[model samples]
Target: MDILSLAKSVGSRVEAPLTDLRTVTKVLGNPHMPLLLALSKGFVEPVYRAAFLASAASSGVLHALAVRPCDLESLAERLRIADEDRPRLKEWLDMGIRLGDLTKREGCYKLRSLPAKALAQPGNDAIAAALEEVLRFHVPALLNAPRMLREGRRFSLDDQDGLVIARSTRVVQPLVEEAIARTLDRDAPVRLLEVGCGSGAYVRYAAELNPRLSALAVDLQQDVADSAAANMAEWGLTDRVETRQADLRTLDAQPQFDLVTLHNNIYYFPEAERVDALRRAHDLLAPGGRLLLTTSCKGGNIGLEALNLWFTYADFGGPLPQADELVDQLRQAGFDDVEATRIVPGEQFHAFTGTSKRVAYA
Candidate 1:
C-alpha cells in the first residue's frame, strides 16, 4: 500500500491526542502538508461540504434526524432556526450526526475533526484561497460534463489561470528546481529545452542555477510565449533563454538539448498524441540529454480515478500512464536509457520524474 493508504488504514484509529499532535506536528513541519492544511482550512472543506450536501441530497438523506447526541436545537439556533422548526429540531440534529459530517457528544453537536480540519489552516492560507478558485472552476466544470458531451461541446481551461499559477510556480517549480539541482553537473554548460513553457518559471530557475545554461521555451500560444519571454526578460536572461511558439508534436528543431522538460502539460494530449509527443521529446535530446516529464498520478484521499475521469469532460483523452509504461515508451522512442522516480506525492496527485538514457553522440 502507498503512504496515503497506510495513513487511511490507520487514520481512524490514530485519531486525536495520540495522533493529532503527531499529525499536526507533521503538518507544521512538512513543506507540502502545511499548504495542504491551509487549503483545507480555507476552501477545500467548504466546497466539500457543499458537494457532500449536494451528493447527500441527491441520495435523498437530507432531512431525517431525531434525538441527536448534540443539542440540535442549539446548533440550529446558531445557524438561524425558525420557532416552528424547533419542535422537530432534535430529529434534524440526529440525522446530521448520523450523516457523518458532525459529531454529537453529551448532547452537543460539533463539526467532525476531519471536516473541521477542512477549514482549520494555521499558516498557508494563500494555498487555501488558491484551492478555492481551483474547485470553483474544476468541480462544476467536471460535474457538468455529461451535458457538455450531449451538446457536443468541448470544455476549455481558459478560466483556470489561477490553477495554472498555483501549481506551476507555487508548487512544481521549487520541486523541479531542487530535484534538477541535485543531478546537474556543476562545471558544464547545460542546454535546456522547456516544453509548454507557460511563463518561463523553469527556464528562469534553471538559468539562475547555471549562468552558462542556454534554454529554448516552447508553447503553442503566442500569449504564453510572450509571457515566457517577459519572464525571461525580467530575470535579465533574454540572451540565454529564447521563447518560441511551437507545437511539440510537430517540433522541427535540431535534437541538441541536455535537459528537455515537459512540465504540467503532459496530460492534454490524446494517448496516441502523448506517445508521439514523448517520441518527439526523446528525439530532441543530445545523446546524454535527459527528458524530464511531470504529471499527476493516482495516490491519496482525493480519488485519482475520479479526477482522471473528470478530465474527459474537457476532451482530455489520456489518463496518466503508469511509471513502468512511461519508461517502456521512452525506450520504444529510441531513448538509450530511462528511469522513473516519484518526486512528489499529494493526497490525489503524484509527480513522476523521468530521466532519459545518456548516449554518445555519433
Candidate 2:
C-alpha cells in the first residue's frame, strides 16, 4: 500500500475541510493510515539508529570521538570494531550523522554537541547506557510477543545484569527523588525501606538529602545487591544505608520503616502476587508511616504501553494497574489516606502514597 505515499497523502489532508459526514467517514475509514505514518516516522529509521547510536555510545565509540574527531581507521582501531566489520561500522557512523548523534567533517566523524555532552557527563552517560540496555534486554522480549502470547510463557528479566539495573536507576532516580520529596516531610528523620532497590540510587538520594535519614534496601539478585552496595559506598552513603539480597516475599515482616518504597518494580510481580507485595510493604511500615509506590500506570504513554505489552506476554512483567485500581488495592491492604498523584500526567508515571493505619495509643 505504498505506506510512505499514503503517509504523505494523510499529511496533506490534515487541514482539509470535512464538514460533510461522508467526507469525514471516508477519511476516518482508513485506520491503518495513522499507524503506518507513525511507524514510518517514529519507528523506522530514527528508532533503528537510536538503538545503534546508543550501543556505540555505550561501547566508548561516541565517547572516544567526544574527545576528538577521528578518521574511520583510527576509530575502528580504538573501538576494536573488527577488521571485516569496519566498513559496516563506518556506515553506521554515517547513519549516526543522519540521526543527529554524530557529525562528519573531512572524512572524520565526531560527536555532535549534545552527544558529546551526553557521553562525557556521568548522569547523561548512565541514561544513554540505560537506553542501550532497553534496546538489548527489553526489545528482544517485545519482538517475541507473538511466541510469548501463543506459548503463554513469560520472559525472565531476572537474568538481566546488574549494570543494566544500575544504569536504569540513574535514568529515573531524579524524577523518583522529586516524587518522594513531595510526598514526605523532608525535615523529619525517617527510616526508609526500598524493595527492588536497583543500585540504591533512591536510598542514596534520600539519605543525602536529610542527615537524619537512614535506609535498608533489598534486591533479589546478589549481583544487583553488590552493585547497590558499591554505589552506596561511592556516594558515601554506606554509613547511612544498608543493602541486602533477598526476595521481597521472604523478607521478615517488621514494622521498622517510616517510608517503605516500591518504585518501578511492581510489574515484576504477577497479578496475583501484586497485592500481597503491597501488603508486605504495608507491614514493613511503622505506625503513621507511609508506603510510597511509584510506577508507570497502564495507558497514557505509547512507548510505555508497548513495553507493557511485552511484559504482559512474558508473564513475570505485566500491565500496571490504573491509578484508581492501585489506590483501591492499597485500601484493601489496610492502608489509610491512600492517594495517588500522576507526577507526569499523560506519561504513565505516578506516585501513590498511603499511610499505615496503625495508630500509637497514648
Candidate 3:
C-alpha cells in the first residue's frame, strides 16, 4: 500500500504491514530540520551528557581525571578495564572529550569542565551520587513508566543501592545543618534521637554545635547503622553518640530525648501513616522536647520531580510529601508550636520544627 493510503487506514502514528524504508525516507525532508537540530542540541545533548557524567562519576573516571591527566593505557589500567575492553573505554573517553567534559593533550586525558572537577572534589560526593541516582532510577522510570505500570511492576528496595542513597541524600546537608543549629541548644546538655541518620553526619554536626549533646542515631538498615557507629567511633563520638538499627515506628519510646530529628526520610512512610509516624517520633521526645524535620518536598527541579515519580511507582515507599501537607501532618501528630521554613532558595526543600505537647496517641 502507498503511504497516504496507509496513513488513512491506520491513523496518525501509522502502523501497518512492513513497508519499504525508501518509500518513507524518499518522500519528504523534515521541513523544520534546522529547528529540530537546534532543539536537539539544546535538549538531547544534555541527556547524553548527564548520562556520561553519571557514569564517569560512578566509575571513578571523573575523580581520576580530576586528579591528574592519564594516557589511554594508564586510564584503562587505573580503571581496571580489561585488555579486550580498553579500546571501547578509549572510545568512551573520546566521547567525553567531545562533550567538553575532558581534554586531551600530549596523549593524556584530564578533566576539562568545571562541573567535572567540582563534582570530583570532596564534600561534593553527594552531588555525584545524585547524578548516579538520576541515571539508575529516575531515567529508567521516565523511560519505562508506561510499560512498568501496564505490567504492574514496581520499584522496590532491591532495585536501589541504599549506600548510594545514603551518600546522595547528603546533597541537602547544608540545609539540614542549619536547621539543626537553629533547633539545638548551644550550651545545655541535650539528648537527641535521630531517625534514618545517614552517615551520622548530622549527629556529628550536632555534637560539634554543642559539646554536651549526645545522640542515639537509628537507621532501618543494619549495615548503615553499623557504618554510622564506626564513623562515630572514628570521630571520637563513641562516648557521646550511639547508632542503632531500628525503625522509629517500633522503637522503644523512651521519651528521654530533648530533641528528635527526622531528616529526608518522610517518604519512607505511606501518606496515610505519616501523621502516625510523626506521632511516634513525638512519643520518643521528652516533655518540652523539640522535633526537627527536613525534606525535599514535592515540586522542584527535574531531579526532585523524577524522585517523586520514582516513589509513585515504588512498592515499598510513598511519594515525596507536599510542604503544606507535611506541616499539617506535624500538627495533627500532636506537635505544638509548629513552624515550617524553606531551607533551599528557589527549591521546595523545607525544614519543619515543632515542640512536643506530651500527648500519647493510641
The candidate maximizing lDDT is 3
User: Could you tell me the TM-score of candidate 1?
Assistant: 0.59
Which prediction has more favorable TM-score, 1 or 3? 3
lDDT tens readout by residue for model 3, 145-219: 999989999998788877788888998888899888878899899999999998999999999999999999999
Q: Positional deviation of 83 in candidate 1, in angstroms?
A: 42
Per-candidate Cα RMSD to the true structure, in Å, reads 15.6, 8.1, 7.4
**Native-to-model Cα distance after best TM-score fit, residue 238 in candidate 1, in Å:** 0.6
Worst 10 residues of 3 by lDDT: 5-14
lDDT of each: 0.61, 0.78, 0.86
* TM-score, per-candidate, Cα-based: 0.59, 0.77, 0.84
| Candidate 2 residue spans exceeding 4 A from truth | 1-44, 71-108, 112-121, 158-162, 169-174, 344-347
Residue-wise lDDT of candidate 2 within 282-359, one digit each (tens)? 888889999989887887555566557756765465676778888888898889999888786556788999999999
Error of 2 at 335 (Å): 1.2
Candidate 3 lDDT at 287 equals 83
lDDT per residue for candidate 1 within 1-362, as digits (tens), equals 75433333444454545646766556345566545545655775466565544332222222221223335565565546697787566665454455566666776655554533343333333343335434554566666777877899765656445223433334445566666675555568999888888777777777777878898898876777877777778888888888888888888888888888876676667666666778788878887677767665544334345445545555645665566676676677766646666665433233334455656856
Scored by lDDT, model 3 comes in at 0.86
Clashes of 3: 0
